[model samples]
Target: MTNELIQAQFGPRAMDYVRSSVYARGESLGALLARLQRDPIRLALDIATGGGHTALVLSPLAKRVVASDITGPMLRVARDWLAENGAENGLFCQHDAGLMPFPEGTFDVVTCRLAPHHFADVGAFLHSCVRVVRRGGCVAVIDNVTPPEPLAVRFINAFERLRDRSHNFEHSLPDWEAFFSTAGLRIEHRQQFRTPIDFGAYCDRMSVPERTRTRLRVMLLQAPAAARAALNPREVDGRMTFDLGELLIVGRRAAR
Candidate 1:
């Protein structure tokens, strides 16, 4: 049921994600690229490759990249986008992140960017990533994160769910650390950054109706002082904008 809902929500907006400035360019992407460049990657697996942006970025760094997504429509869009961009080393596959259809230790590097908050089972997904990545290889994750404060976490997650039904919940930094440990991956590097979201574009990308958008706007505006302060909503030239906290975590699979 969750997978069906996610596919339905994202299938039509595949191109929007491909062209989205937030996904196409970001410090997190740059950081991931730099980290990958430090070592040569024989083959990389990009799970939940929404628009093939991360695979495109990894194409030059890795000899081969498998861009996998669960949704057929999304995978098709990614394939088309990758072909159009001349990213020849990328291969598209329809696969679930939590249950990848690849042999263990098949990839030298694994990545999932800007997509895990929607994952139904992030721990299982990480375990699959660990299973597929060779020992001493890298697993990079870039996703929006919630604050440690219980109220702040609740508010941000509520806001996300209200805006997009596909959203699960944003995990905190500590949660990610624990997940990596449980997956037998050692966290080598971590960084936190903010991504500015244009409120209008955010709504339009999801094709949110005007009534729901209005309600969301009111909710944001009426949020408690603590929540509002954590969100840091701002209006510039009559356009609403806010920052979403994001995290980049690079871990290494431990050798036997």
Candidate 2:
């Protein structure tokens, strides 16, 4: 989707993300935090900082944190969240992740969480992350991923795109690793997690229409055996639910 379309898609639901337990306190967020704590951070940038949760996590560790997103409404909400949390050093900027305005080697570390699948060009995004971080610095990422099986890949991406129009494509672990390598980032840490998503709430977050919801449910229930295995869809307390595959990886640039 174009940047404008993505902005329009998420602008109205900015607060939903801020209040989302999955975004605010999910295990993936915690894993990113733990990995970051092992390194020293003076200045950090959180790209696509959708509710600014990652930026909030970095504020205490870094002297300054810049939270950026393509969506203005999201930045505003994130700013409020940081301010409410006493993050005096937090700053917000509006920009596309693929075209960051920061100068080369300006930040000690850069992070993007749960947002890359919406990026039109993941490679370009990683290039920006590498360019803005100093040599020896790190670029950490966390996003839902799809399995390598072709049918499973198509099924998962289709499912997500139906749920959120802004969703572009979710890369597999191998795709992400290859992208990191091409961007001159050396993989330092890699871990996976299965995040349970409440089907109803997930659909509501994006305002999926009832008609579309039925389609999604049908896709889940009648998915190919491979897709079903990858998604692990199940009923929880009479509510449909499924596991989202997440990959968290930290790639460090070679020291000069």
Candidate 3:
């Protein structure tokens, strides 16, 4: 998964994105902690620890954590956030999840959340995850996924790309499962997190050009009736409101 775009796009706006963004809201730390059957320890890694939420949430559960990202500025922000959260055990590093510098079988628990869609090579990303996690260790990945239907997937991905140039693709549930399996990980748990992004706020964060923003609004508003119905497009007082969705999925690195 190439991160050139993410590095360029988020490197400068790291702090702003962390302070006010969609990923920071919804899905409490307790929810993620509760999903873990056993405490994570021995070794752990949090890839693309944007805002350091995942590191702060999972730090205490693990003996050690290596939080990494492609952008140095973003990693600095994560470092500060983790320090503020009193998670001194967490360490931040600049690394590409697609081409990590860590050794194989180094981590017992690995996680990447809401960041995969920025990866240009999803399969390569998964393979890297599989490499670092020990056999029978866990790799939990959370990302926005498109609906299985081709049309729905197309529309969702297209809109997201228009909204954020860093956007790559959101794989459906089945595809993600197959992806992990092919990389020697087995699905152990999964959940969907539907986060409604206030339309204007969402548009503002990207600093999307005015014309592009207008295009996005018109495209979403003019979505096919069926798509709109299925999405239950949120509207506030007869106006388009928000649109967002995500999946919190966990997979175990099966012993070969």
Clashing pairs in 1: none
Q: Please, what are the lDDT tens digits per residue for candidate 1 over residues 93-165?
A: 8977898999999999999998899998899999999999998899999999877878888888888898899
Compared with the true structure, all predictions reach lDDT values of 0.90, 0.94, 0.79
- Name model 2 segments beyond 4 Å from true: none
Return the top candidate by lDDT.
2
For model 2, residues 23-117, the per-residue Cα lDDT tens digits are 99889888888999998999999999999999999999999999999999999999999999889999889998999999999999999999999
Query: Which tens-of-lDDT digit does each residue in 161-189 have in candidate 3?
Result: 99888888888888888888888777888
What ranges in model 3 sit over 4 Å off?
28-30, 237-239
Number of clashes found in candidate 2: 0
Give the range where candidate 2 is weakest over 10 consecutive residues by summed lDDT.
Answer: 224-233
Candidate 1 runs further than 4 Å off: none
Name the lDDT value of residue 163 in candidate 1.
85
Ranking by lDDT: 2, 1, 3
Count steric clashes of candidate 3.
Answer: 0
